[model samples]
Every structure is written in C-alpha cells, then in structure tokens.
Target: MTIRYDLPLWRPPSEGSSLIIQSTIGCSYNHCSFCSMYTNKVFRIRPLEHIFSDIDAGARDWPQAHRVFLADGDAMSLQTESLHRILDYLHARLPRLARVSSYATPDNINRKSVKALASLKARKLSLIYLGIESGHIEILKRIAKGASPRGIARAIQRASEAGFQVSCMVILGLGGREYSERHIAATVELVNAAPPTYLSTLQLDLHRAAAPGFVPRWERHGRPFQSLNDDECLGEMARLVAGVAPARPIIFRSNHASNALSLGGILPRDKEAILRTIAQARNAADSWLRPRSLRGY
Candidate 1:
C-alpha cells in the first residue's frame, strides 16, 4: 500500500532521506513573524489510528528503514504517552529503527518534565531539532517568537540532561542590521550555556507569506526593519562564530542553501578558520553570494 504524505512536508536537512510521519499538522505556535512555513494550515495532532496506519504502511514498504522523523512543525507537542506509543510502535514494526526524531519548540520541551523527556529518550526518540532563532529577548519579541533566552537555555539543558542529542539552529540575519551585536552576544551566551551537540545557522529569508505579517510589526514599533545585505550578513555570521565558546565540542554548519556562504567545522578549534571564510565571503564580489532569487525558506 502506498502512503500519501500531507502537503508542505518539512524535515531537517540531515533527515532528507528519513521516513517522515506527520504526528501533528501545522505549527502549534504559528505566530513567529519571520516564519511562513506553516501559515497555510491549522494546528492539530493526528489521530493515533491514522498515525498507526501510516506507520504500518511504512513498515510494510520500508522494513529496512533506520531513521524516522516525526513531522509538521513540532511533533513533540504531543502528550508524553502519545509520543511514546508512536515511538514504541515504530520500533516494534521496523525492527531496525535506530532513532526517532522531531522538530521541537521550547514551549513543548518545557511542557514535559525531565522525567518525561528521559522516558521518551529511552524509547528511541533520541534527537530533537530545535530552532532557537535568536536569543536576544528583544529580537525574539520583535519576531513574536514566544521564547526567551533563559527559557531556551534551560529547556536545552533539560533535554541534554535527559540524554537527548540536540541539533540547535539560529537564524543569522534574524535581527537584521540594527540588533546584530546584541543578537550575537546573547545567542553565544545561550549556546555556551546549553551547548548543543550540533549547531547550524541559516540566513534569514523573508518569504512572501511572512512579509505581510512581519513588515507591519516593524512599522508599528517605529523601527523599520533593515535587512542585512550580503556583506553585512556575512559580517554578522563572522561575529557569531567568533563569539561562540561552547563548553563541549559542537559540530557547526552554515552550509544551508539559504546561506550566502557555506561553512562547517567544529567550534572553538575551527573558530578562526570559519571567521576567515566569512571574511573571504565578505570580500568576494556581490555575484559570489547566493543570489537573492535562489534563496528560499
């Protein structure tokens, strides 16, 4: 039996090939001003009966599958028991399943206790892809992120303590030109405190859907949003890399398709090199950066 996917499927870049199961529809908090990914749909958790049928279909067709990504924004929003049951069913049916992962919001992570997180981790839900966006409280507020720097750090710390490997992401140009420095400093502080297993950066792209909601907010604040140019964006990236001093080694990447310059290395050890690469990108001709037309969410 062929399983049909819900429209507008999304997964982390690394999970491109993993089987994606939509445990939730849309994003529970779809109000982030910078995000347009889920603006077209309403948020709802998939029924267990439907979810189970999808899993059965996947197991029948892809018995050798090892990685599974629960989808549609934040699947971790599901109740602890519901998530565990899904994980249990996936592992039981696939037999070769090694990990079950999902995109998680800070709110969702905070909703569960460390004990609940530990239980999920024990059941093969080993990783969470968290979009930290920006750590500056003001920037978060401006973007309607509904997350604070301290709250984000504590949530990551709790997940880490629960033995969940976290891959956290920050938007490089989220604060635009005005708030760049504070954004970098606060984000570095947060990362240093929580220290994710993997850290990735994506340059901000103002998709058409997001612009309608985002622009007015900037206008209402009496501070016009000044987007960073290619050079300015690279400069912000350089400062961010240089400022981060994590307690543990973190695999870092700025190689997302949205990024003007591709960069990857372990933190601190490769810090100088990453900075130098950003410098080179800054010095390169305007044509060298990823073309604006080519960039997408």
Candidate 2:
C-alpha cells in the first residue's frame, strides 16, 4: 500500500528521517507574514480513518520506526483527546515507537494545561518544534508572528516542566538591518529566561515568489526592509551567541540550508568557539560562507 502525502509537505530539518504522518492538511494559523509554507492549502485536520490508514501502511513497511513527526505545520494544535487517539494507534502499530513530535506555536502550548501536556508526554508524544521567529515585540508584530516574547517563554517553560523536549527556532535577520540589535537582544533574553532543549537558527529568506504578499505584509508598518548581507547576518549571529547566558546548557545549531555558516555545539560551553568562528566568517566571508548560489530557504 502506498501512502499519499499532500503536496509541499514540510517537516523540521531534524525530523528528516522519521515516518511523517499528515495529521493536518495545512497550518492552523496561516497568517504569519514571512511564511509561505502552507499558503497553497487550506487548514483542516485529516480524518482519523485516513490518518490511521497512513499509520498502518507506514508500520507495514517500516515496522521498527522509532520516531514519527506529525505534519503539516502545527499538529499539536489538534485537541488533546485527538492527539491521544493518534498516539495510542501509533504505539499499537509500531512496537518500537519511542517518540512523537510535531511543530507547535505558543498558542497551541498555552491552550493545553500542564496535566494535558504530561498525559501526552506519557504517551510518547514528547517533542515539539516552535518557531519563535523573533522576541522583539515590534518585529513580531511587523512579521505578524502573533505571539509576544514573554508569552513564548512561558509556553516553552510550561512544556519543559511537563517533561517535553522543546526545540526552538529563531530566524536570523528576520527584522532585517533596521531592527537587528533589538531582534538579537530580545531573542537572547527570551532564550536565557526559558532555554529549550535544542536551539537552532535559520536565516531569513522571504520566499517572495511563494508568498506573493510577503512584501506588502512586511511593508505594512511603513518600514523599508533592508535585508542583512552575508557579513551582516554573521554579525547578528555573533551578537546572539555573545549575548545568550542560558540558565542551563542548550544544544545550539545554525546549519540550516539558509544559514551562511554552519555551527553547532552546547551553549555556554562552546560559546566562545562559536563566536570566534562567526568573527572569522565575518572577516573572511569569501572563504567561510557557503557560496551565495548554494543556499536555499
């Protein structure tokens, strides 16, 4: 039996190896200005029977699949009971099922109580990927992120307390050149306040062709978007590395295809090394950065 995935399925870079089951058709909140991921499809939860069919097919083919990432966009936005049913079925079919993860937003986490989260964690749905694009309120509003920095921190901490592995993502140069300082400073503050288990960075590359409204939405605030060049982007990354003082160790990465330079290590431990590399990249950009033609969103 073949599983039919909707066109343009998206998963976190880390979930590249997992069995992907489409719990939903598109993003529940498709209003973010910078995202064109789900603009083609309207949001709707897949029927339970349809989802179960894909699960059974996946198990039949990959009987020992240990991890599954529910797609598309925010599967965590589904109701608590709905998630429980899916998790129950997944364990029933895949004896080696060790983890279940999905993309999530602050609103999704906030809507679920600690008890609900703990219950889900018990069922092995224990990881969540969040896009805290920028912590600066002005930048957030300008990008139509719909969540505040403090609120994001609360959601991250809440999930952590309930025994979930939280992966947070920050978009480098999201505020472009104008708000670079504010963006990096606020992001550092948020991460320090509520550090996630994994922290990653993806440089901003507005898919104007995919998102026809990106420019209009971004220009809504009457500010001209001045995107940071390769060196400038590296500088923002350096400032972020220098400013972060997490309460605990955090796994950091900047190897997304969009990043100019790839870097990964545990924070506070490899902080200096990462910063020095960023400095080197800034100084010796031609050698350090990926060729401009090699990068993708």
Candidate 3:
C-alpha cells in the first residue's frame, strides 16, 4: 500500500482573520486519548523545498497573507534551521506577514534553547500555540502528554521571555468530574508560573475514537468516565480565571467548537465580566448539554 503523507489542515472559527500554513504534517505525539485531530495520518515534517513552494503558491493565491498560522497538531517539531528557513521564506514572499504561529508541545519548545528561540523571533516567528492541557501531574499522565507540568512551565517561560506571543490551551474539566478542584488549582499554579499572552479553554467532548492514551477504545464502555456537567464545567472555568492574579495582559479565549460557552477578552480587565456572564447563563438554567437530538452523532 502506498503511504499517504499529507498533513491534515484545519482552520478554527477565527481562521477567517489568519493565513494557514502547513509547516509539518500530523502530530509527533499522536497517543493522546481524547484527541483525534491527527489520527487520519502519521506525522511528518514537510521538506524545506516543498514548504518554500507552498509559500510561493500562497503568495500568488493570497497577496495579503497577513497573520499566518502553521497547521496540524504541532509544527514546532521541525528542525530549528528548517523552521527559520521557512519563516525567512514566508517573510520574503509576503512582507505583509504580520505574525506567524504554530502548535508546540512542551518537549518541542524545550528542545530549543532560549537563544535559538530568540533567533527565531527575530526571523518573525512571533507566536507559539502550546497545549499545556492541565497542571495536574496525574491528568497529564492520563492524557499521555509525556511531559511534566514543570517541564511545560519552563518551556512556556522560555518561549514568553524570548518574546513569543505564547498562547497555551487548557482543557476544562480535564481531571474528570472527580478531580476538578485539583485540576483547577494545579492549572492555576502552572499558569501563574508561565503566564501566557493567550489562554484558551476547551471543554471535554468525550469521543471514543479520539481517546489519546493507553485506554482501550472499549474501556470507556466498561467503566464510566466522569466529566463535569455544563454548569460544573463553567464553574471550574470561573474559579480558574477568577483565581488568576491581575498581573499581565493575557487574552482569554474559548476557541474550540465543542465548548458550550464561548468567552474571550483581555484578562484581569474582563475576568469579572466573563465570570458574570457564565453566572447569568447558569442562573437562567440554560442547557449547556447539546440537546439529545444532536447527541446521537
């Protein structure tokens, strides 16, 4: 059988304002239990020659590729030299490329030194999308993240201090329903240490095929997995956001389609307002659950 090495690309709802680039195809860490983002294909880094060709194509296709986003699970796994060359080529092709961003794992980020990161920033690779997931060590282990919270913190701090607009993702109710408080507390601790410029929360949507760890596809059928109800999930989010100290100008967002509540604003300034919005939704007895009509999918 011929192997297909195509990278699966996806644009979020906000992709309307951004240009998409597939720097690397698929994900290096494809074992996460709750993810199916890259299961359709194996991971592979695109050749520099091919990437440059795509850049040329993009320039011709969209003369104004203002904000570029490298796609798939993570693009930071590319060699530092190759990444730098790609960035150089992107800027050369599109002078209007204001910002470039990509998904990065803790391992990918820490693999490069602070100096290397600084060099990349100078080349216009200004943003990094990190999936910190959760701060709890057990939850990290549960997700097969293959990295510790401290490791994540160090990598994020390195990226941030090196001037990358670090946007880290947090999964609300990640610790299952039982460990929500621990998840919230530990996540807050981690965020406090490596405060990112952007923080996004994705509510857990239990998908059997998307399971990312050692758990069997049928295991969820054997033992029930606990996930927070909608109100509980929102409460957990409120606590996490409210607990964060008013220090930096962090942008908060819930960018995933699975989330019932969509919240975005500059942190500290809109924290209270966001919380009040969630509170109002809860008070109004709104249904956070997708109606049964749509749940059969």
Candidate 4:
C-alpha cells in the first residue's frame, strides 16, 4: 500500500470511496459523553510533511480521485494557516482533486474567521461533517459536547455564509426515553432556523467504552437515562422528518448503521413518503426495519 492509515480510522459513510488522509489524530474535544470514537488516542495535528507524503502517495495510487476525506477526527482543528498549506499541497499532488472534507467540531468552525473558511472553501475544502449530536442545551451539557444549541446553529450558518456545504448529524435517542419529546422539539427548531445542506441521524447505541462515562454524565442531570426501544427511536425519527420544514430544502438521511431504518430523501420534499415508511414499521418485525441483532453504531 502506498499510504498507511492509522488503525481504527473513520469517516462519514459517503466518504468511503474517497482517499483517506490522516490530517489529525483523535478529537480535540474528547469529552463528549456519548462518543468513544477517539478515546483510544490523544489528539494532535499531523506534521505538514507527513500529510504531504500521504497525498503524494495517494496521487500515485489513485491519480484520478476527485474527493478526499481527512481523518482521524476533526481535521478542522488544524490552524487556518496549516489548513491552507495542506489544501494547497493536496491539489498540487492530485490534479483531479475536486473536494476535500473532514469531520469538524462546531467550536473549531466558529473559531476560524469567515474569511479563512471562505478561502479554504475556494481551495476545495468544500464540505464538513459536523456532529450537532442534539440541539437541546441540557443534552449538550449532559454529554459534555462543548457546544450549545445556539453555538451549533451559528457554526452551521457561518459555514453556509462562507459558501461551504455542511453535513450535520443529530443522534436519535440522545435524550433517551425521559427527554425524547423535548429533544426532538429542540432539534427541529434549531434545524429549521439554521438548516444545513445535508442532515444524518444516528441512533443511540452506546459502545461499552463510551457507556461508562455516557451514563454517569447524563445521570448527573438528576435523572437516570433510560434507553429507547426501536419503536420509540422510529417515532423520534418520524417527527424529525415530519417537522423539518426549512426555508431551504435539506437532504436527509438515516442510513447510519445504528439506525433501525435506512431512509433517504429531501426534507419538505419527500416528507410524506419518508414518514409513511416509518409509520408502516410500527411492527418491529416489519421488513421495513433492521433487526435488533443487526443494528450497530
């Protein structure tokens, strides 16, 4: 192999076919209660020379590649100046490179100036995968997400203003059973106010590694977290699809492995059909939903 990736690397499902480059190691803010994706490593930016070597190798392997996904966690944590240099190197190495994307934390996006973001966008860092997680302020704190509803919305809006497409993910059962209704309501309001170009849903499936901290953190809110059943998870997803009436259309997806159902369509456009499928899945045994044993995060 021309390029060797750090083990346990991850990227959005859509980026599976793109060349993978480790621009950073782990997440900058590793305190999110419901996440274990980066618990195994400390966060740090890759040296520019190492990143350049990876790009050069990738070009030799797949010169015609048009898209690349920066990994291992939020590559956006790199300084604006560092990112500009990385983007410049990527294009110079891969003549066909058309887009470069990475997971981004809301804080990181908000930290950079709009002019910096716009410059990055112009250089083909055209999209970011943001995990809004949940838009409810209480949930945000309980999870130690390091971001509030307002802050996440501001990040999304700022990215749009910079002409960058944002792909945001919201967890389906972040609030569990007790706060399900409130979670969905708050999330709906936030998305309607600051819509993203794409939105994806992830059902709550706490990893054994993440569950230790995830449960305790939420209980600190004065209530024990109760896991949601498949039926309830579907209900929350249905409400999200039904309520996502954005001024501009949002491309919605629930294809994450954790979700019981895999759905895709444009909100406020294919809303009815999306809801109808969920409605029909009232029976857990319905062929419409993935079986319990098959579900994963």
* lDDT per model vs. reference: 0.87, 0.90, 0.79, 0.89
lDDT for each residue of candidate 3 in 69-160, tens digit (9 for 90 to 100): 87777888888888888888888999888888888889998999999999989988888888888999988887778899999999989998
Residues 1-297 of candidate 4: C-alpha lDDT, one tens digit per residue: 378677788888899889999999999998898888888888888788888989889988899999999998899999989988999988888888889998999999999989999999999999999988888998888888999999999999999999999999999888988789989999999999999999999998775336444455767767778988778989999988888899999999999888889999998999999988888887545577787677766
C-alpha RMSD by candidate, in order: 1.6, 1.3, 3.8, 1.7
- Residues 1-297, candidate 2, lDDT per residue (tens digit)? 777799898888898899999999999998888888999999999999999999999999999999999999999999999999999999999999999999999999999999999999999999999998888998888878889998899999999999999999998889888889999999999999999999999888765324764564656667678877778788888888888888899999997888889999999899999998888778885898888688876
TM-score, cand. 3 vs. native: 0.89
Candidate 3 has which clashing residue pairs, if any?
Answer: 31-212, 32-212, 33-211, 33-212, 33-213, 34-212
Better of 1 and 2 by lDDT: 2
Judged by lDDT against the true structure, how good is candidate 3? 0.79
Q: What lDDT is reached at residue 123 by model 1?
A: 94
Candidate 3, residue 275: how far the Cα is off, in Å: 1.8
Among these predicted structures, which one has the highest TM-score? 2
* Candidate 3 wrong stretches, greater than 4 Å: 1-7, 208-223, 287-297
Once superposed on the true structure, which residue ranges of model 1 sit more than 4 Å away at CA? 208-216
TM-score of 4: 0.95
| Best-to-worst ranking by lDDT | 2, 4, 1, 3
